[model samples]
Target: MKVGLGLPISDPPSLLTWARRADAGPFTTMGLLDRIVYDNPEPLITLAAIAAATTRIRVQTEVLLAPLREPVLLAKQCATLDRISGGRLTLGIGVGARPEDYLAVGADYATRGRRVDEMMPVLRRIWSGQPHDDQVGPIGPAPTRVNGPELLFGGFVPAALKRVARWGDGYLSAVPVERTDPLFRMVEKEWGAAGRAGRARLVGQVNVALGPDSVVEDAKQTIGSYYASLAGTYDVHMVTTADQIRTTITGFADLGADEVMLYCWAHDPDQVDRLADLLA
Candidate 1:
């Protein structure tokens, strides 16, 4: 299975350093969390920086809020990033759930799902270079590839799954241990309905921790707040040793996940090294 590293975009200095490190490591892809007003960097800008610094690692926005921005503009930005990255960009999009995020961006949270549905066709049109009165003609100087970046839709709701079937090239799911079967079932159904059963990719994200007592304790202290809200839900973060992580990742692959993005909540750079070793 393809492995990706999820960096904390909230810390620009550390994120940049980690991106460079990950580029030199075994990771095939690097992902950034998208949060406009929260404690995260703007994904496109961060991705652009990563594209400039790395030569091979594919860059991804592991769930950008599509409903908050104008589709055309976002599409243009993604296309530009794809060009810079030599077509190594994957645009992971979702209708954000946080009401405060929507309010902060002056978007109605209730209308986000509908807005995302409306924006997707426009975004795809922009990517495909289809002439549209609403879109910027031809998407600028052209992308590195004929199509723009790969588009992945993320969310757990049935409506979200339907949207993935209708509009996305793949599904990005954060599957809890209990919900894994249902999530894969929905993805399979959607993929079949979209006529993309084998074509569509499945990328799953999981929280991980590795090493001895001090290391584990340190990781918990650093990432505990970030996962505090997801303690019991399907979003429950997993804290496991390196061996456990390898076993779990293998399980995900067995369940048809094409790629698994490891979100290491630990701030230590050594954690990435440990993860790379464990995965190896």
Candidate 2:
């Protein structure tokens, strides 16, 4: 099972330093979260910076809030990022649940799920160099992989899963492996029902804050704030020791996750090396 790093999108000085460190680490991929009502850096633009600084690590958005942005422009920006990243982009998207995020972007919070359903086809149409009309798509430069980045969707809702079956390349679940297994099975059935021939990727996320016990509270607080108003509760696993984290990851691997991205809650870049050493 491949392991990726989910680094925080912080202020320039700190984020750049951490991005560079992650690039040089043993991580196979590096990703970020998105928010409109928060102070977090923009995922696509930050991904562009990461692509310039790294050669091997895949650059991804854990899940970009697709409904908040205009679909065409979002597609253009993502394609450009994919090009810049040398095709190392996995575009995970979702209808962000935060009402404030939708309001901030002037998007219809109630209709976001439906908007996402419409957005996918438009994105794919643009990426495939086939527009429905002159104003709609077939936008200039295409994505690096030809059909845009690896499209993945987040959420376990029935409608969301139907959208995945229709357009997504995989499922990005920010849940534990135990919860992910059944979802993967459902995804498989949905894919087959949708007439899709291939197996969708299952990317698992586990919030981990390793290091001394002192960092646990700080990690929880940071995660809590980041997820404030977005989720009912924020769960940042305080893996106090290397042995504990290793066992946790092995459990995820055993659950058949195609890849697992570890969301690091520490601010320092040295934490990257520490986790790498532990995983080594």
Query: Best-fitting candidate, measured by TM-score?
Result: 2
| lDDT score for residue 119 of model 2 | 88
Clashes of 1: 0
lDDT of 2 at 104: 82
Local lDDT at 17 for model 2: 74
Tens-digit lDDT string for candidate 1 (173-248): 7765446767777877877877764566888788776767776676566566654544565355675676777777
Q: Model 2 over residues 45-109: C-alpha lDDT tens digits?
A: 88898888888889889889999999888888988888878899999898876889888868899
- Best-fitting candidate, scored by lDDT: 2
For every candidate, C-alpha RMSD to the true structure in Å: 2.2, 1.9
CA deviation > 4 Å runs, candidate 2: 10-12, 132-137, 230-238
Q: The CA-based lDDT of model 2 is what?
A: 0.80
| Per-model TM against the reference | 0.91, 0.93
Tell me the whole-model lDDT of each prediction, alpha carbons only: 0.77, 0.80
